[model samples]
Target: MKQVEVTLNVNGKDTTLTIPPRMTLVDCLRDELRLTGTHVGCEHGICGACSVFLDDEPIRSCLMFAVQAAGHRITTVEGLLNEDGSLSDLQDSFWECHAMQCGYCTPGMLVASESLLAENPDPSEDDIREAISGNLCRCTGYQQIVEAVQMTAKRRREGAANG
Candidate 1:
């Protein structure tokens, strides 16, 4: 297979690389771009472990081709950092709430939570549950993850009101 060139805007940086047409976006981001934050789980879309933001929408990178992602913006788990390199509010909430155990599902959970918060900053418990339903977590029984997202929502609302 001939390798093709593709450019992806990831984490606010433009990265150009040559990859096989069959390469998945997750592989491109991990193998070529050295952004290993996006983990590969089932390799099938069933496991959202390889989730990332494609143009600000959460998608399964393992199911997306590198060529298909050309000229699009991507945000891996690594991109969810504060400007000062500190953990973002969502990540902080996860930590404060003890949302992760083995942490395999954390990246996907974080992406899902972020997507929900982006669309609905003030989400109900049911809404949070629905948003994270796609991302499976074998640890913490999802209660901590829900609590983390709720905590993040509350903090974001409080911060917005204060500012």
Candidate 2:
């Protein structure tokens, strides 16, 4: 296989790498970029563990070729962190609400939840459920995840109102 040079804008930084055309975006991010936050569970896109933001929209990185991601902005789970290197509100909420167990699905859950919150500042429980439906978690039973999103939304709204 011939290697191709691809420039991907990830976590607001542009990086160029020479990689095989068939390499999946998840593999590229983990292996080349050393962004191991995006976990590889099902590799087949069904697990949603490899979710990341492609141009600010949630996508399964496992389903996308590295070459295909060229010229697109990618935000891995690490991108959701605060600029000061602290946890974002959503991440904090996940921790406070105990939304994860074993932690395999956390990256995808955070990406999906953050994407949902970005679009809908105040989402109902059903809306959160619908938004995260694609990601599966065997532990935590999902109630805690929903609570985490709700907690983040309420905090953000409150902060906005106070500020």
Candidate 3:
């Protein structure tokens, strides 16, 4: 198969690479771009482990082709941090709420929660639950994850009101 030249703007960096047409975005991120934070649990897209933001919306990278993502902005878990290397509010909430175990699902959950909060900053518990429905977690029983999102939302609201 002939490799195609593609451009990917990942985490605010524009990268150029040659990739086969069949290459999935997950493989491109992990193998080519070295953004291994995006894991491949089920390459068939059933698992949300490969979730990332495509144009600010959460999408399963495993289901998309590298070529399909050209000219678009992509944000992975690695992008969800402050310039000083501090975790974002959603990430901090995860740690404060103890929302991860084995940590395999944290990336997806974080990205999902980030998307949810971006659209609905004052999300109700039910909204949080519905937003994270696609991501699966084998630990924390989901209570902690939900709590983390809620807490982050509350903090965001507080900050907004005070500012």
lDDT of each: 0.92, 0.94, 0.92
What CA RMSD would you report for each candidate? 0.9, 0.8, 1.0
* Candidate 2 lDDT by residue in tens digits, 89-121: 999999999999889999999999999999999
Q: Pairs clashing in candidate 1?
A: none
TM-score of each: 0.97, 0.97, 0.96
**Who wins the lDDT comparison?**
2
On TM-score, the leading prediction is: 2
In TM-score terms, candidate 1 sits at 0.97
Of candidate 2, the 10-residue stretch with the lowest lDDT total is: 132-141
> Which stretches of candidate 1 lie above 4 Å from their native place?
none
Clashes of each: 0, 0, 0
